[model samples]
Target: MIVAQRHRPSSSISDDFETQGEKSFLRFLTCGSVDDGKSTLIGRLLYDSSHIFDDQLAALERDSARHGTIDGDFDFALLLDGLEAEREQGITIDVAYRFFDTEKRKFIVADTPGHEEYTRNMATGASTADLAVLLVDARRGVLSQTRRHSIIASLLGIRHVILAVNKIDLVGYDERTFDEIASHYREFAKNLDFITAVPIPISARFGDNVIHRSTNMPWYQGPTVLEHLENVPVDDAYIDSPFRFPVQYVSRTDRDFRGLAGQVASGKIAVGEPVVVANSGKLSRVREIVSMDGPLEEAREGQAVTLVLDDQLDVSRGNILAAPDAPPQVGDQFQAHIIWFDHEPLIPGRSYILRTECDSVTASVTNLKHTIDIHNFSQIAANTLAMNEFGVCTFGLQSPIAFDPFRSNRVTGNFILIDRYTNATVGAGMIDFALRRARNIHWQALDVSKSSRADLMNQKPAVIWLTGLSGSGKSTIANTLERVLHASGRHTILLDGDNVRHGLNRDLGFTNADRVENIRRIAEVAKLMVDAGLIVIVSVISPFRSERQLARELMGSGEFVEVFVDTPLEECVRRDPKGLYKRALAGDIRNFTGVDSPYEAPETPELRLQTIEAQPEALAMRIQEYVERRT
Candidate 1:
């Protein structure tokens, strides 16, 4: 029988772990299919290593009897599955992080959930892990989720992996079972760019070969899990790579003490070393490296220090300071691997907030290259990515950002896509490389600007966007509004939805993804019309609020006026002039807004025209009056 090791004083452990000396530390996560014993393995490690306190052990014993899955025995998984729901369901949900140390090295282990629904949480755990401990059930050789987690780990830059073949005792500790499973996994992980894939057979429930050698598996002659974890070389090569420092804050503690405050993401920086602001390409020299302890001569990777510059350059937050000769790439377009996390499919042309280390910008997936098939690792053509789907796509940003390829620098290349309206993280992406068009294309300077064109036309250029359910009198109101503006000597253009679709968007469909692209194209044309000094009127269903918000952002402040033609769905069905409502109701049409698809009504439209409240002409006059007042 295996016995728990003796415990060390908590104070000494804390001091040893927190000390910033030359001790090596490793960050790893355990992941696999559900019920593969990730939590049990972590708990066993914590328990057998004597990291559990007396109160915690006692609580585990009491809680095991209440929520135990091991027939009232000591359920090791109870230690890590802290959530009540997790305990009741006997599953891991959120990533549970725990820290422990042996005499050899300190470790931070993340026990990630194995459920397919929580793959995003697993990805989050892998994002910061240097090594991955992928668990697999002995009965099942390699599952789809196993391949998926492995791919995600590779994408997140984790090169070292330990294939822990768990539950060997359940399969009678057969050497053939272990060998076949390990062989299959190694073959599957061949293309993942893993530097090392070590396979170890262990029964986490019995604590066999977890912290000590197992007599039950005498045929398996290999180092135990703890031995491998303690001996594996921690990769610290980022310190030797190119220097990169993303300025998080500009310290202006009085004018005499101006400094750029941020952590050095990679490489070493010494005083008097020439650095360049990546986006602006302005050159300066590092005057001082100030740390909390005092001024330092040099700072390496992972060091938080304030850098005082020799020159008063135009630098601020969200700017990258890099070595003068090896500055990062600055571009507005790039190709990246995206792991979509939102329930709503990732729609191209729909804008999202792209947040990197210290920078935020409006970005959209311009094109979806293809999605990876987890079952066979094949590339399949797809226009949109669903939840937990992996795809390669081209992204277009509103402004240029400085970044390196993820392969060379994970810190600078990683970013997350946030839903602009909900402020929820929808996707995680890693930059592969910048697109050639980003470097080739440049905006030409024109002496005559939008203001000059509007002044010449003697009118304030704007886009009057009319959105509502289909069959709602949006087109009629837009036509009347444009007519009135034209009669008032305002240069005006009307872009009816059907008219534009007949030409500009002829190839587009009514799917959610297509609708996003349709609106994006119309918004761009409307922006161009406004730039030409014309008042552009757009009449479309424009269903999704996110797409409408995207249109609003493309225009100048107050230049995009949303006019909601508030017509009831019953009224829209009653006035089904185009026979669309009939077809949609009869199941002949799909993805029709107000029928099958969703139409997110404007929350705070500039003008809400209730068809029941007034006639079309009167509503048109109301919009005209509003625009005139704004002018």
Candidate 2:
């Protein structure tokens, strides 16, 4: 019989996996937009680890003969180019998953495509990765696609990043070159919120420092590719993240046993422990924990175990079981960061499926806050998340669903959006806020309306609406100014371009009418919030002067602080830190601002600040001065 290695959990089960010596496995994915050598890197890891089967090797040899060899040897890419179309084009066009095991642990690697058309597939591949091994070629270094993947990884709550600097041989494996790449990547990583990150140098083609130490690199002294995978501190496993087990299937056996069956997604559960059901809010005791082998004393995270409760509870698929001490909140609305993968933009009123673990519900895009420029990590005013764009968007669920913050429990908090007709997963979302607090605060006709409350609080509901072109430093200035006002005990809210686009404004598009509507909605919301006694600050690339004027008309006179975050188009495109300017120049993008659309400069404004120096501090102080004068 072929031996299948089974990982045994440590006895005397402490919450910490380190104490038990049972190193939890992390499934990491390698993703980029395109031409990032994702498949070749996976093949290199598989081949170097001596995991290639004899038959697979024979097939590779035949393919190499048929297609002609790259270096008169087997081309590893031949193994990963699965689809006939992909083989013909010699590019990864689908999500390709490969599995291997090292002495220390087992690993499941997914090599995802980096093409714009395969964005949905990329999301599917990366949805389950505990860590994302984002690859950047030494020749190309950091590209827009690289940044997109990094942002997605962060938004998806992939806590760890192993930035594999692939194709080091192309850059002569020079230490200076590697250091430069690492330095640039480090700067980018600052924009992300991962728990830990490590940059490593590797030549996937030659298998340099993959499974074994590299002979060519004398300057680099670190673990091999396999070693890093085997021993990069597997402390990030979500075993302690408050027990969250989504009931996948309920079983009623012939014997007197009815149990809830599903994978223990996070945390531990012991027999006789008080557990809370998420959907029904019913509490019960875990009489026994069952697996394929029958009864068990306890079950830990990531284990596919079933539990028989003492009381016969009405639990079904999508229902979550949690510890009573830290029960998950159930809500019909959740604030999430979504990445739009559909060809059609996400319509705010349209309903789609939001799938988290075993739970699936119809969810509507309640708000599209803002869209993020993945390159420079800046926000832009966007009403809808177009194809392959990342944004912060909120979803209104069909029913109350139990979930925790993605930061606390990824399995419980993360969800995927699906097209109803094709059942195709079009987007991935990470929960930011539960929205239950908003429910409590949104009681109609109870004590007071939100606007009246704000009025009583002595703050007019107004958005210090700042409008400008790309690279106008709207966020930088707004953030600094908000901090100043907040320090002065003025209730302030800074709605930045990128952070909001990721959520609230995600449903709006870049078209002229869409842009107008986008600003209109934000202005209305800002007015309500101001009426609720908050000094709301908003920064957006609102190109249409008429739209800005209309938003101003919505607010009371002097309440609307129309600030013009002015930076010349030439300088804006020059700073093109996000490389959007390069994409626009390449003719890959259409209807791009400053290229296809006319940007009307504000004729008259309360404040006009130049952002040519990339310093928003001076502009921020100017705005602070204006706010001080007004208040």
Candidate 3:
């Protein structure tokens, strides 16, 4: 065994120490593969730092006897895995945050899960963290999850990392073992852009090299985990960056007082500083900086203050205030990295609600560039992103918004994608940069408007969309409806699903991605036809409800009519007019609606045509009457 080094005096490190209230704050997270002892390491830190209370310790001892996994010893993991499901399963399911303080620093540590299914939970914890504690089991060194967490940490802008090789006692505290794991990890992490990747051998269960140096590994000479954490530099670069204030709310006390209330996202603002609205380019000057305690001379990064402008501009919630000389990029198109969280795969061309710090707008992923392969860190071609998958995509917004690149400012660069129908958060994204085309393209004014064109044609513009399963009578009814409307001297056009495939959508296939593109193309065409003052009829087997909703949003309110052809699957299969169903069932065709593929019926449609209840001519006449009344 190697001899232990002589004890050094505490004065050698006195310059790095600070008093309690004056200590700097650090936010960090612990993450790794399942059963890698993330929760245990955090629990040890709290216990050794004298942050635990007697009552809490008593409760912990009692709980440890029942649910502990350490052969009746104190289970440090019990302190953080609080949920009953987590305790019973001996795993972390949600992100658990705990706050503690040392003499030199204050800390808010997030204990994240290690399971593959809960990777999204890990990302949530990493978002606000400045550093990451990546724990790895000594026996299972450098697993795939280790690479995945490192990639996520890098993307989230964390520059510092601690590679805690836990369970060192199980490997006999061997120096060779620790060196091999540390060297291998450093080789893999060199490309991740981490400024510091310090490897420390620790046994969270035994508390070795955690808060105190380990006697078992005399060959290792490094600062304990707590020592390194207390001395690491905290990133405060936002203070030097350009000013950014996202207007959260407009505070109005009386007719003469209108103050914009928000936290300064970056830089500083003073009473006389000139500011501009980022999206609108309206100029203004800060008249007064109002805080809760009354007027203040200035406010810097992270301070929440209200600013009274010298001029009355049209600024409101969702407008960003910035220094006139360094305004953020304003555009409607961008390239971003997205981590999908929902079970449903992300479909391109489907509209979602994109929510930023203070703005929400309709947005869609126009193209998926590639998905990262966690095992090899390689980019693979993909059309969609599934749950727990990360991809680089191009996003198109309905309206322009101001933003900075995520590397420049995390607060102004991050956004979440919400499902338009369910309001559930489906994906999290980071803006890279605004696309050049979005800034170059401009909408030119036209003398002829939709209303003017409609008046000239003597009718209201509309798009009637018919959706149903394959082999249904949608095309037949559409043909009959157009004939009835045309005979009445109404300008109309019919766009059938099969006819368009031969010309407009000739490059498409039967995959889900191709189907989405097919519906998108048809919707755009129908909208153009409606703008030209024609009653456009679209007949297609639009299987997905999301794509149908996308089509509806492209038109004006109440101008898009959804007609669901409610035909029984059995009836449609028997009628198989084009023999498509026969081929699908015999394995000659795939992705056939109502067979291998799913057809989501509309929950609420404008018109429900029961084909079995009436003939095609009669149903078409009913549709014509409804259109006449609606128009």
Candidate 4:
């Protein structure tokens, strides 16, 4: 759950209310285990601050009556328990977002669930938080769950911690109870790399020093929780930090004008300042700061604004804008801390679509270093990360990318792994360090033309990519074609979906995305082999047409042949060559393609085989004949 750190501190507050009513806001989240009273604490803050409306209060009163409470006393927990299950179980389940304003600033509080099951949701909530409020029960003190929460918060880049020792009333409001809990929290927090921490004792139910002064706790002398939140001196929000503006959207209001639109994640930006894009590392200058209303002289960090550049650049979504003074490195490899959220574990060597602020690239996990034990913050050797597990790993991107460390800038450093087939986000990664030095193998480009390579290999460097349901004889026909070509003195290579995996694609699996990357790597290797003057035969159950199109693009027209082994799904399931179809039908597998996934059949193919009735040699001769005509 370690996330990107760093924020731009506000240098000066604007007092011009009439011309520009720009108000700064701080976002924070509260998270912990169940029975931690996070909802109660939030409700107390809102109620004591008088932020609730009259009608809302009346509804709350009615709800309290339904719950069998007399006198309609404020059920502080009612403010955040919006879900039916939450009210019934009296436990928070989802990340409930609430907004309230104070005289000093605007606040957005994300009340996230405390259950270990919902750790991913909690990480999502705290990903955007500038600070975190961690609650500890005086009786339980700092338990294992407490340690887990603190570790996650710290790893998520929420540097500031305000530990609230709730239910002090049960502890006799004793100073000893308060001190003991505080001491334990301090010791646990010391192991984490936190910026600042403050522990305070209060009874959330009795409203002791939450917002107003508590006469019951006369022994404690310090500012109330609200006071500390309001007046705590935050460093320059982003002025001193490196500039990072992730281009979220491109705006072109008129045919004559164009601009890049996104929020400034960190640092300040001014007109004519030189900027570099992380994708291409191309430098440019800021021509104007385009706001919603009009142009601005300057745009500070955290402000969502459009930027007009002096030069036409290849800037797009998933790209970052940085100051020229210290540009970020553009590379394809890096080490990162990943919080895996999907039910399917991460597969090493399988390429996924890695997306950050404005840049997206096909990347693969090169290695999994180790996972951190949440309760202890100790490293444990793990092959794959399951749901809510935090691990350090190295990744290999397809293209070079420039990025700052998550500790330096949160916006440009955070990334999500998307399944190319399912489009589901599988993992959240924070760039720990970009490993620029990776081993590279250089292949000598022959002076022979591509067509010459095809001739030298005796067959054209073309990809006969076979795809169909399992047990479709895709492998049988492809193997037959390879032998016939060899007898004809035509050099060819057959990349069977399962066979090449032993060496070329050994690190991938059968998930939707992994399958796509499986085919992608095969296609890439096929292209290279095609360049080396060998006709490539690839047999895989590439169910998606989009992936086939990608393969086609990689090899170019007339090179990539989509050969449909048109076998019906029902027939293949009946065949059950690998027993996968039987398992899928038996409900042992959930995301099995051709059953759970919709396999898009090719509308057009270079060749089509209805069945394996034709002899393998006959099929091979037919493919060779087709190749001869094309060449």
Candidate 5:
């Protein structure tokens, strides 16, 4: 008979010799705040389970003596956190993945970073994990970082959560403290959609309730962490939820053969089953499912194989193949929860490349509804989302795409926003659902034409936007220009900012987020007037370039003219006709564009007027003359 080691690894982690053939695999993650002992817990698991070799143990002891965090005892963290920087800082900086096996199962545990700034890295680890082991310091109880990580794990669709209350020894192994923390976490989790959350108190340093049950905790009668890992059910329900295959590659071996190659994102595929092209609604039956060995009769979710269709249908990367009868919802608009990751704040109305699987299209955030407060989980109205911020917003795609609600099908609903110029992934979004109106409302073909409307008025239908500082004479010049147009028998309307605010936009404030929405609403109104074949002159201090460009896109090509009324800051301050600048300079006004907030100048404008150098009447004449030449 073989002698069991002094450290009896749980039955789940029985020795390699006593193990049976073909163990199943479990992929999990360990996450929490820095110094919460995530890496140490993994190292303890590896050491106590006998996964560490004799040589590795000796090396760990030697390193522990020189720079161990806990006196001269063996520092298990040194084993998992392999980076030199991690050793020096005594914190896990990057995600460290380790593979180990026991009698019942194999395991892949990701030890992710815990700092708030490295949230994106944590998100990456959560994406592939079937279970998330959330570590919390027993002495500290619940924390904001812990809540944020839990929210992320839930958002990524990980239904199983293991709340590992680490370092119980430091808290005197008190059962009351453990229960209190667990209760707090449970109350917070009520808002989250995760299915199950199990709390277990453990001393990762002493191997208590990890691979072995602890003698100190006589009151507790739960399975060890190792035992829980062995029993936790891996959800394979996605395989039966719905069939969704994003075409990633086109395998054309020769003229005789062509295959649509991609991993089965969800559900199963079998020969003779009908599949629909999500983008084009083209239907075709599956002819063959081929693997490396040969043709297979069927393939399930997570399998990589080549699919041969019965008919010669047009299908390429970025196209989604789905069940013919239960098609994904198709639309050009969505309400989504997005996490911003780029250094630059997400600019509303700025065009980005929205990529889902292989499909990439021009897209933009049409509206920023509100942002989530991680500390208390409250919704705060926002104009833009900064790095690591989560916000609810509306998205507009250049073209319609097929998708399911993210809660129902992650493969078909999750997308990333890539910068058009740099191609950097700036944001990750999960679709709540397609906008109701986007699916229900269809554009009605109008009988009256834009050309006919303009002809009836006998003039050009244009939108001349006046943009500059507060006291830059934009309104004065616009008034003069409208008078000149009226004298010349042209139809015109002057939408002065102050006049509109008294009625249309009285509810809006001067916050950056509010400012973006202010411009968005005005742009829509301008588009409507331009369609009516009237010369619409808009005078406002539109500060941001992205919002200005959005207004341009709303109008026809060459119909929107941006007039930059350039005035020196000194000149504007001296001529603070409304005393607004005086209050702004005195710190009474907040989010005042030039005084406090940011102002992105137009890189190139249709017309430029230096108000400080010339009279308003002269500038108005110049603008009128330019319009006449263009029309």
Candidate 6:
């Protein structure tokens, strides 16, 4: 065995450690797929680095003899995973953390789970890690799960990655095998956000190139894993970033002393610098920065302090103090990426509580753009999100929130979705950016509101959307309903599909994308008419449930109703008034509903009437009666 080196110069590790007997700390994590030797590598690091006590080593040797993965030898994985279940199953379920010190530096390591079902646990560990040590099994090369964890590590803003090809002995320590695996990973990592990547060949089981250099691989000459870990630079980019302080609590112990207590999230704040309360746009000057020991002249990021302002203001929890010259974006709409955690699927139009940096707001996911395929980072169209799924979505908040992009500031950009009824955290999100329209278009204050206009007209404004198959008597019923509504002294307007197609939607075709656009235009027009205090009736074959739901969400609650005319396809074909159904059936036209294309019926409609059983006049009166009750 090689003896320990006589001197480990602190200068080789960092220039800052030149004057210190005690060293700075490094936080890192070990992550990869199952059976990739994450726990074993960390255990080996602790053992060979001389950080373990004699008693602990004795117990580890005894345990290894009793229960080892390999026959008649010590098992290092048992050191980190000490639970009975983990020893029995030989798989990690929860994150394991350990703290150790070396001659050059002090370190804390988090050993994360490798199973696909425990990705959230891995994410939780990676959130606070400054570096990631990604392991790969030499026998299996690279797997899909390996790429998945790498993508997540990049998304969490980890800049430095050390790719460790563990179990190199199993592959005969072949130099060609290591080079091929490293090349494949480097090529695939081109699109990721990592700053630097270094590959190291090590055998965790036999301690080859782990704590000391290995002789088996004579073709490779590089620093060992421990040597690399001791010298990698810790990210200090947040020091130059703009200052941000999110107030956590108000410390008002006495009438004369009131201060905001929180940690400085970014940059540096001086005692006399001007700061702005981001939520209310109020300005103030920093009077004092008080720590537990005494007052400080300035505070940098990560220092907890009680800030006293120059003027007395109504400050409370969830308020943010930021640099006046460059404040964070404040808006109610944002484009974000979310990782769903709950078993129940996400409802696009339902309300949930979104919490970020001690602030909570009522929020709804207004639109789902797509779900990502983690294998290749491809986008697939989706209407809902399920458990363990990643999606790109847009959210509408009840009030404005202050934040930066997640890539810039994780403290201000990350949020969690809480189930309103169960109080469970159901999803996690990272803000990509604030929607530009939400920032530019401010709500213009008006003296006359929609309610005031409706009051003057002596009726409630609403949209009665009539949808069904083609030639289902939707227009006939709409005509009768308009006549009935007008004779009752109510102002109304009918927006038929043919009239809309002739002018506004004339450019659209019968394709799915065109249908979505057609419904979007109609919804916007109907919203404007409702604002004018008119009862708008829309008659069309809006087949897609997603578009219909979009129209409902565009209006205020209870201001829109869906009425389905349930006429069988056979009956509609027999009474083909427009002859479009015959052409659709004969394959003369493509994307024809009920023939080639599919129609997603409404799960719950306000009214479903069998048009064959009753005349158009009777059905129209039935709708009128329901409208009168609702109004």
Alpha-carbon lDDT, every model: 0.92, 0.77, 0.90, 0.79, 0.86, 0.85
Candidate with more favorable, higher TM-score: 3 or 4 = 3
Q: Write the per-residue lDDT of candidate 2 for residues 366-481, one digit (tens) a residue.
A: 78888888878788877678888888877787678888888777788788888764577788888988775457655455566656776666654456988887776777778888
Candidate 6 RMSD computed on C-alpha atoms after optimal superposition onto the true structure = 7.8
Q: Model 5, range 356-468, lDDT digits (tens) per residue?
A: 87688888898889999887789998778998888999998888988888888877888888876567878888899888554666689999988889999998899999999
- What TM-score does prediction 3 earn? 0.93
Please give each candidate's TM-score: 0.95, 0.66, 0.93, 0.77, 0.79, 0.69
* Error at 405, model 1, angstroms: 0.7
Model 6 agreement with the true structure over 352-464: per-residue lDDT tens digits: 78999879998878788999887678899986788777889999998888988999998888888987656878888899999866466667898999988998889999999
Clashing pairs in 5: 383-513
Superposed on all Cα atoms, the candidates' RMSDs to the truth, in angstroms, are 2.2, 16.7, 4.8, 7.6, 5.8, 7.8
Best by lDDT: 1
lDDT of 4 by residue, 14-107 (tens): 3223333444567888877687788888888887776666556666676666652224366677788888888887778889998776768777
Off by over 4 Å in 3: 1-19, 438-440
TM-score of 4: 0.77
Error of 4 at 455 (Å): 6.5
**Model 3: per-residue lDDT, tens digit, 361-459?**
999899999999876668999988998888999999999999999999999999999988778889899999999784656789999999999898888
Error of 4 at 457 (Å): 7.4
Candidates ranked, most accurate by lDDT first:
1, 3, 5, 6, 4, 2
- lDDT tens digits by residue: candidate 1, 395-471: 99999899999999989999999999889999999999998783766789988899999999999999999999998
